[model samples]
Target: MLYILFMIGLIWLGWKLIVFAIKATWGIAKVLLYIVCFPIILIGLVLGGLIYIALPILVVAGIIALLCGE
Candidate 1:
């Protein structure tokens, strides 16, 4: 019947639209993670390393200054 054929076509169109929407949203999420999240994570790692290196040197210098003063 013609009505059944029309219904099938409508369902197929709806399915295609949903697939396109999901793909678009996934692509946007990937771009956001790469452009924004990645840099923030990298900066955090660099800062963490800097702090880890600097704190020990600062403590050592303080100890030397205290021992030499007295």
Candidate 2:
């Protein structure tokens, strides 16, 4: 019947709209992770290494100088 065909067409259109929305959201998430989150994480890691390694060495040197008192 024409009614049944109309119902089917509506369902198909609804399904396509839902799929399009999901794909759009997924694409946005991918772009944010790649462009924003990844570089921030990489910069944080590099700064963390400098703080962990160089900071302690400088502190120890300062303490030794203070104790020895030139």
Candidate 3:
């Protein structure tokens, strides 16, 4: 009776601890993943922005080159 209740309590405690650990591990994994991927994402964004900014200038230069027969 009492022993059974104690066993149930222990089981409940273990289950709660497992759940907490899993949640904590999942949160850490997400943060680490974001940290690892952020730089690559940032680099891609920077390159994309540079192309967006430079493409018009390049087109104008090409037009000038055509006019100059170069």
Candidate 4:
């Protein structure tokens, strides 16, 4: 009975750790996407002669940033 309880406790702890790891990884991924990837993508779009598309995207991003400002 004691062994069974110990095993269950270990399983629960392991599951919680996995959940925490996933949440942490996702948060880091989002930060990288916004800080690093977004500007590179916008620059590429403009340099590739897609200014028409890039301009509207930039405007919408600006509006979102303004509205969502902390």
Q: How close is candidate 2 to the true structure, as a TM-score?
A: 0.63
Taking every candidate in turn, the Cα RMSD to the unseen true structure, in Å, is 16.2, 15.8, 15.9, 1.0
TM accuracy, model 4: 0.90
Off by over 4 Å in 2: 50-70
* Range of the 10 consecutive residues with the lowest summed lDDT in candidate 3: 37-46
lDDT (10s digit) by residue, model 1, range 1-70: 9999999999999999999999999999998986788567656766887767566655675798689966
Put down candidate 3 lDDT per residue, 8-61, tens digits, no spaces. 999999999999999999999988865776446556666888766466655675
Best by TM-score: 4
lDDT of each: 0.80, 0.80, 0.77, 0.95
Q: Considering only N, C-alpha and C atoms within 3 Å, which residue pairs clash in candidate 3?
A: none
lDDT of 2 by residue, 1-70 (tens): 9999999999999999999999999999998986798567656766887557555655675798699977
Selected candidate, larger TM-score, 2 vs 4: 4
Whichever of 2 and 3 has more TM-score, that candidate is 2
Q: Give per-candidate clash totals.
A: 0, 0, 0, 0
Off by over 4 Å in 1: 50-70
- Superposition error at 49 for model 2 (Å): 0.9
Off by over 4 Å in 3: 40-70
The better-scoring model by lDDT among 3 and 4 is 4
lDDT of 4 at 4: 100
